[model samples]
Target: MQLQTPHLTLVLISLLSLNCGSWAQSAFTIDSVKLTLLPGNSVESGTKVTLRCDVKVSHSFPQLSHTFTFMKYNTIIYSKNSSQAMVERSFTPARRSNSGSYQCRVTIHSKEKSSNTETLTVRGLQTPLLRVESNVVNEGEKVTATCSVPEETGPLQFSFYRNQQMFMILTSNENSTNTSVEFQESGESDLHCTYRHMEFPDSSNSSNIERVLIQPVTIIPSIKVQPGLEVVEGDRVRISCDVLGHSKNGYEVFLTDRETLLMSSPSSFTHSFEVNASSSGRYVCKVETGKTEKISTAELFVAELLSRPVLSMSPQQVFQGQMLTLSCRTLNINQERITKADVKFELYKDQHPLKEGHTFNFTASQSSNGNYTCRATAKNITKESKQLIINAKVPVSPPVIRAVGQVIVGKPFQLLCESELGTLPISYTLLRYQRPFYTLTVSGPQRSAVFNISYINHADEIHSFTCQAQGGAYSRFSQALNTPVIEPVSKPELSLGFPRGQTFTEGTDVSLYCSVQQGTVPVTFFWYRVGSSRPLFTSRSSVTRGEHVIRSITRDHRGKYYCGAYNDAGQTQNSEPVTVGVNLAGWKKAVIAVICILILVLIVAILVLFLKKARTPRKRKRAVELSVKPARPKSSDPMRMSLTLDIEDNTAVNNTPGVMGRNVWSDHVSDSESDDPGREEECEKLRYTEIQPQQPNNPEEVALVVEECVIVNSELQDGTQEDPDHQTTDSVEYVQLNHCNQNPE
Candidate 1:
């Protein structure tokens, strides 16, 4: 019974006409109570429980309000007032201490009476009982056993047992269900469990005694390969023996190299141990899991670390391609099978891998002479051999003794001694008979080494150095190699185009010649301008063929010039500058002289005509001048004449000169007058512009009359000079007589 609200009396008064009982007015009474519990419904120890209480209410009770008391057997466990029309009591789940009868009593305020109590029997699964469902178990399989219940209406609690020892206890549950205890794989053992109630008066009980018999679990131990087969001291060697598949149970693990045991564990486990020189061996392992003690033994060969293998030569140093047999060995190693030795030998020369071998027997090479060592690779181990230095006694490769040259005095010239090839790891001691007179150190591991010292005044035998390369047991000194004590290449002195200090003109007799003072090898000549990039005047080119041939020169073109002498060895020296200068003085003077002569002739004729004009009737006469072409004029046209002034040049001078300026004269007036004979009057009367004075005096320059009444004595104006030398020819008078003017002024 329960109360819907706190004011039960006030609610009953509002609904009822009057009070029936004197002491219990407005209070409802319950006639009876019944509590029914579901099967397997109980609580575990230290847990909660719920008791459902149903009350019957009719018209006899107008309103109901009640207080309830929860009882265990005959004792009152709890008491409380009902907050609703029905009453429900909550308690901790069933446990051993709480296993007893549970009942609830209700007092009704509406009926003004107490109801009879209802009871429920609570129970729980007991503890300390172990069991297994299956009769037989296989290896490497999960081991399973469930807790059991003896006899009870309450929930069950479970506990697991293995090998007669308690392993785990399971929480209680509702049914007479099979609770399991699991193992990865079956092992020789016993199994059981305990079952109890899930809810309370915290009450519980356990199930019956059960024993589990597992069949033989076959464990086959498998070998495992440890990582880093090659290692140094203090490295961990981990070995494990685990049963394969379901046979993981009942196995013992062992660690070994081959057959020797290093570690062991009672069950499947990994065994790790730090290793050192004393811990080298072949390894395997075995296990005993069940009925049969599985025997799987592996060979563990303990390693006895030996000294690193070293490669050595009987004769340390020798000539290139000399017979060389490098004997290599690691001390204290059982070398029956070099493979078992577990150490590989590396052959190194010139700081590079020459070969990888167990032993060495081969010819030495020029390239083979360098830092050499033998590296022994043991099983997961490395040891560098002691320097076996095969001093191939390469005589230090003649100490490629190079002499240092300088224009300064007393500055010690270093004679670099180097060997391109020799036995390796060779230190060099340089000895020169001079201040720094004693031995000086040099670089090397090879046959060659370098030695440097100051104040080496002996240029003659300056590089006379004795260099020794000591390798292994062999040592040898080298004969000094001389660098030919050559002087540095000097700029070849050059002279181009004849007369020096002038420019070169095109189409002139340019002689590009270069020479050097005391030069080695026939100096190859090259010519270039002052500011130009490459050589312009090359050796004997198609364009530059002739020597000087001009009697007197002109200046149409010119430029700067320089030259270099060289050979395959290198550039030698630049020759002294030779510049050709051309003034065109001769050309201008000759033109001026011819024009002056023609003027004088015209003046004389004009004077004679003036006198004759006074003497004669003074009749006007018209004249025509005709000019003929050089070769042959067409038959329809009259032959024409053109004056060509040929200025000769001095053939001895071959220098090129810069062209300063030029003067242009047209022949149109003379040609038109000559073509028309009737125009001779105008031609005779024509007064041409006067010729300029000769060019100023220039060094090595002379000017004079080149030709007068310039005739075609040689050839066409465009043709080549008739001859390089002078050839005198008969001259015809070419006097222009003026018929228009005769004066005596």
Candidate 2:
């Protein structure tokens, strides 16, 4: 026999493929289940919830040998056994009959189903009432309080507290049933409130502790300022008040400063008032006694008086062997309680008495020259000050400062200054190296002072010239004329103090300051290098300031570089052409920091190979051999049903829950349709067909998917199945399964 007829046709095709996979898993039923909940069914009573149980399996049995229980209202509450098509249960403080009905049965291996019972309410939050429109409050009085919560709990959030801390948070309005607040006392104790539910964890319990007393603080009325409050502006101050023990026949008093009220007395203990100068501020002293009113403030401070006597004179003009100083101080305008009294000064001269106390030393003659007058008598006031004349003069010799012309390079020169005799009208001053430049004032009596000297550079050749001669407070100087050493050459400027866009690479250091804004010193400076004619550096600077450093910069220190500036009046000035390029060295910045660390390690290895191919886990889509057909070509109302699928492996096609749509799919597909190859060949010939309608203990029926439409072709549409204008006309045929989180075993 030909190989035993091919091993008896492969054992009858392996016993008809194990009897068609045991009749596709015993004609799989137990199709619909679901019971979810997890974080919501309106929870909150002590929190912790869960519940799960999924199990719907039958898209040609992609896996489902279940056994989950759960229940809740009919009792059970959790029983396992899973090949898992989903199962869970938690609870934690969840009671109140764990909130009514919840379902979830499942079973599968022998059929069973259940689900849809749902409910779960669990509320519980209500404990916050805190009231107090009054329980005694009178320090600065106001105390309101309120709080509430428990109007069937919904939009809460209050907070208040006080002796236990918190203090105010009442949000105010979401149907605001309570949550007031005024609080003003200085002593209270225990007050509370605690509503919750705004960011929910549903809190509420802390509200019945009201104890609040807060009363103390009424004793004010004391004001007493007689010789006090530091008065003194014509002082006679008295302001008293004292009503703390009240009585004077229903009191009255008054006296304010919180913006004026000044005086009102009647319950007098004293209230004189004199320290004026706008009485300086904060006063008060209330009293009232009728509806309980007692104030008391106090801060006065007046001061204001003296204002005058100043007189000063040291050397205001007088010379004959010099010596004269006169001073007389007073100034009070409120010398803080004014007290330095015994002062007495007198000077007069054209009117006779010459001098008496608060400082007066004299020696200048012409009989101590004239028109003086200073008086000042304190304690009883007498102020005179202001009248000083004093002209004693006579003495002016040392002058003779030279320099007269033609020391040229540009003309103009004349200094002259002369005073070798004595006072006629002095005041000269010309100095140069000692720096005073020029001054001349020989009023009317002529004592000589020329000073013309127009412009001469080279720092005027080491300057030296002097002359000075005043007369009254006598002044004299001279003796330093040696200035005239052949001067003139000015013009030299060359700068490069570097650092400004600086770029000198190879071993750095490049200084260049060759100066001479007006030229004078030994100068010299020279630097060149443009097209090179020699002289790359040379310095001298006796003071015209010069410099030129280079330490290392190679390639002949790059290009264009000017500088020049010579002196000794020999003339030379060039500067203004710097250039020197070529930078980035240090081994080319260490090879550009090692090529920017290999281009940031090749962009972090291409972003770690695109995040390890986006955290791996892909390659799946293996089984694909679909071929279905079911035709129904051109026929308008024949109730359409044209299906023709032929997938073999452009794999990846999914639609989960019993495969494809029976009305619930669209979590908007596209995980890029498994890397899109035309959407993975239109998701490998997608297909769907639907027709559910078999209730009897409903477990959500309609299954058998390959993306759905298992096989249909009917036509019905003319409303009336209990009309709400009902209409119908169905004809389907779809397929493309496998997606329930994939690995469906």
Candidate 3:
């Protein structure tokens, strides 16, 4: 029973697995979906049509349901869920709105498929009929027009045309439409109407043409002038507006001049007024009735009573103290009405009455500069002429030329040319060397003209500028301008007052010279040291060269020096540097000299003891002695010294000014023989000597050792001074001294 149970369980599990595999693989798919039009794609209106959607399915299941959707122009028109493969939608009477692209969609198990689109065009529209209220109508009068399409659907548009030209369009949901239209043209016009369904605009038909006779209303008004078209001033003129032909009742009349209403009255159409220059224009007569207006025009000319009085001056350009005659006259007059004598003339100055006559004479002055006019009167008619402006000019005096500021060389400056007495608009000329270089016209309230001088090379060149003023016919010249020009100082040369290669002693004066090649006078010179910004000395000189003396120069002045020169030309030129060397102080020089003398004295004392030891006998023990003595002052020679060594007595002597001497003794025992045993015993001696000055009164003289000598003295124990037989000549040495004098200045 266990074995059978296992077999049964296995079989059941295998069956369940097979069922699941089959279910997963059985997916419903739509094979094809097609849309077909029953009565073909193109059909006439009122014909029955049908859209059929056929869907073919391929599925593992025998029964599968599909959702069918019928679409027109992408919009779902009919939808249904059914097990059938084919679905149909019918349009009993196909209209223009039903014509569009038709498609079908089949959906099953969440999978959808669309068919190819097919266009169903229904082409047909009922022709409309056009009718007018009246066959004949007056222009500008409204008439009723009716367009009817009896079998058409709703939402239709009707267009009305006049002589083949569309004039009005109306949209309505009904089969008929009517509107009132006004015709501007007066003639026979063929009117028609076309109707189109809103959904199918391309399907439409024009109605039959209806002839409408438009009559034009002609009621032209006539304009009449009572005083004729051409009338003189001060004459009464009457303008009348009347209709010449038949006009409708309740008509209004208007009399106007240049579109300005002069009179508007239905009972009376006449306007009367005095004619003047302003009234001379085109007059219009207008008549209005209902929606029609008619007009007639006539021109009127108003002649002047007398010509306007003209005020004239004898001379156009009037100056002060000159004869200026002003005359007022009428050029023309109405000879038929009044002669020239009958016309009276008056003159005015600045709107104030001046005189009453045909002519007025006066001399033009500053007071005469004003606006002038004249008026003429004849037969109660008065007219004034245009204003005349008169300006009495004053002759310009001589203009003076002056510098605007201090003139500098190689810099821009201005020169003003002004006249004290002159009228406006005076022409001033800037002359250079008697020739005009620039001319400026002074206008408005400005009385001076400025000339810019770019640069000047020399001081004398400024005298060439002159100015001249001219007003009206009078002109004058000014004197030549004399302005000083300042030149820039050139690079200065700095030098020392002392000679070259000379040392600058302390407490001496140092002079720094600064000179320029070319510069103006009154140049300031500044002296400066190296590495210093402030000047050590400053001086102003009127010449080309300036000197800055540093009083009592010290070692502090021992450095590089430079100088600078400045002038009115606004530039300072610097000089090249010069080096100064200063000597030591007087007390320092004396201290150095004393130290050197002490060292020389010590050397001389040591040399004397050496000589004493050399002169001793070999068999005898000899004693060497060096003697010291206080230095005695030599007359007029303080820095002199003397030292001597006598080998025969074994003695040493020393002499030095302002120095204490001491004795130095030594014992020496020797068993060796001398190198030159046969030499003379008194042949050589050691001596330090001083040569006396040739000029003892000269403080600048000093002794100096020029040559050196070496001496040797040999003596026996018996104190005998003799030469050996082997030495034929004496051993003598010579020392020479030289004296030099130096000035301390």
Quick one: best lDDT, which candidate? 3
Total backbone collisions for each predicted model: 157, 12, 5
Whichever of 2 and 3 has more lDDT, that candidate is 3
lDDT score, candidate 3, position 203: 46
Residue 73 lDDT in candidate 1: 73
Instruction: Give the alpha carbon lDDT tens digit for every residue of 1-745 in model 3.
Output: 8879989999999999999877755666678999899879999987899999998887776687889998878898899999999999988788776778989999886689999999998888766899899989887677888999776668988899888999888999998999887876688888889988888657477889888888988776888899699999889988888886664567788887776888887744678898776788998888877766778889999888787778888898888888888888878777887888888888998889999987787888888889999999888888898898988888899998999988988888999999999887889999998999999999967799998889888878899999999998899999999877788899998888666435688888878788999888889888888899898888889999988887898888788888999998879999888888889778878987888888888888788666446433321232123211113312343221122332231113222121122112122212221123332121122222333323323232111011101111122211112323212222222222223221111
Cα-based lDDT at residue 17, candidate 2? 100
* Alpha-carbon deviation at 615 in model 2, angstroms: 99
lDDT of 1 by residue, 1-745 (tens): 2575658877887656444454344444355676644332454443555667666644343454567666767587677776465666665454454555666666655333334444444443344434455666554334445444433344544545465576775554443444444444444555544444555434333334454444454456776646655654536666667666553444566666555666788766777777767566566665655434444544433454556576777555466557877766777664542454466778776567778886667677655556667787755566676655443444334344455553222444565545565445555566665222344344433344445566544335545556655544445566654544323234654444444665534335655555544333433566666667876654532221212233333463355556666543343456555555655555667898999999999999998777545523311110112121322233354423233221222232222132122112114344456667656434333322122334434443321111211222122221223321211221212322211111211
Q: In candidate 3, list every pair of residues with a backbone clash.
A: 628-661, 628-662, 629-661, 631-656, 684-712
Global CA lDDT computed for model 2: 0.62
State the lDDT of candidate 2 residue by residue for 571-599, as single tens digits.
Answer: 56786776766476778889999999999
> Which window of ten consecutive residues has the lowest lDDT sum in model 2?
711-720
Worst 10 residues of 1 by lDDT: 618-627
Best by TM-score: 3
Residue 533, candidate 3: alpha-carbon lDDT = 89
C-alpha displacement of 624 in model 1, angstroms? 38
TM-score of each predicted structure versus truth:
0.30, 0.29, 0.56
